[model samples]
Target: MKSKTPFIIILLVLAVAIGGAWYLKKAATSQGHGAISNRTPASNTTPPPATAGVNGAEPPHTLGPTSAKVHLEEFGDFECPPCGLLHPILQQMQTEFSDRLQITFREFPLVPTHQHAMAAASAAEAAALQGKFWEMHDLLYEHQKDWHEVFDVRPIFEGYAKQIGLDVERYKRDVNSDPVADRIIQDGKRGHYLGVKGTPTVFLNGREVPFESLPADKLRVLINSELSGSK
Candidate 1:
């Protein structure tokens, strides 16, 4: 009877320990779930602002000639691979529809992931001040891989200016100036107001165009239709 009693006490102790452990584990799991629930809900309700401009809706930052029939506004990140792919297409379009189509390039730098994007944008704006925007734009994309290696883009950008026949000293001074930085920042702010959530968002004739499946032929058709309608 004595031995049995000790064994029963031991069993009780073991049961108590198991119960305590299980309670702690359950409490910890509940806390974890509560923490997760406290986090912001994934936003599925609102489509990104950039996408709002589709079906002939205008974005906030409208450039180019107001009278032009077809307006092509492209929101792009400098470091974006898909933007790189679309760059050539934009160039071709610019060449093909030079007379009718007006293109407005807006900067949407994803700075958290794309370190060089903001600098590239600033550089382009600085070049714009010197009447060399398109030249610098082409150089940046053409040598994206090279400049992407360094976080501080001033040196490489200066090299590009030199290569493009821009005055290197003036380019450097302008790029570092506050006005150039302000222009890039304003573009970013405009992008935010326009609901640009990602890289490579485009608007054609005030309508949002899908980035992955941009229908060039359909776009041409739309422009032609607008042109005909205007006539």
Candidate 2:
């Protein structure tokens, strides 16, 4: 309820130092869009229990069962190409097992390699505040090329917000708010603590999924196995 505008602006101003180098990197990688999926797969690690939301502060952008026996949680970077590739697969899983599944999306922006990762994460969080997180999430991946290389992605984010029917003013304000940044930072930190080393880290029933067995079909098998065990 309290205003966090002033703090967010100051933080962003400081982050500009990093963004400066990142922007240049973006320009250099302009022709490398299809060169995605270069991420190293995460190691097998114990799955930490996930909160219902990003940080247990704001509600998470979830699809399917609000509370179910099988839960799928993903810690993803919006700017990562592999994450983009896996996004629709997750969507398909949700559609197929809508009644029996619970899916939670958490932000994990890998800022070092992906220049616009943090910005995109914040934009999704802000859109979540406006009840359009899923829309903004999809659009970011759908049109990643449009804003991936540009220096000023805020404008592109604003355009997406507009198209998604979010209030531009509120979206701008919230995207620049400290809470959004906190959510992103905390989520990434949690991912690191949980041994999540890359984009598209998935957990099926609190177990980190091996990348080799992370396809939708395999995930369905995991879910069904859990269901069978629970029953």
lDDT digits (tens) for residues 1-231 of candidate 2: 879998999999979978998997765433211111113222122334554333533466788867687777788988988888888888888888787888888898887899999999999999988889899999999888788889989999999999999999999899989989888877776676666778787776665666655677766666676666556
Question: What is the C-alpha lDDT profile of model 1 across 1-231, one tens digit per residue?
Answer: 256888899999999999999998756533310111112221212334333423221232333465676677777888887787777877777677776777878878788789888888878877787777878887888788787878678788888888878878788788779887766676667666665677787655544554433546644555565455445
Worst 10 residues of 2 by lDDT: 32-41
Q: Considering summed lDDT, which 10 consecutive residues are worst modelled in model 1? A: 33-42
**Steric clashes per prediction:** 8, 0
Instruction: Please list the residue runs of candidate 1 whose C-alpha ends up more than 4 Å from where it truly belongs after superposition.
Output: 1-66, 225-231
Using Cα atoms with residue i matched to residue i, what is each candidate's TM-score against the true structure?
A: 0.67, 0.75
Residue 171: error of model 2 in Å? 1.2
Q: Global lDDT of each model?
A: 0.66, 0.76
How many Å off is the CA of 115 in candidate 1? 1.1
Using TM-score as the measure, the top candidate is 2
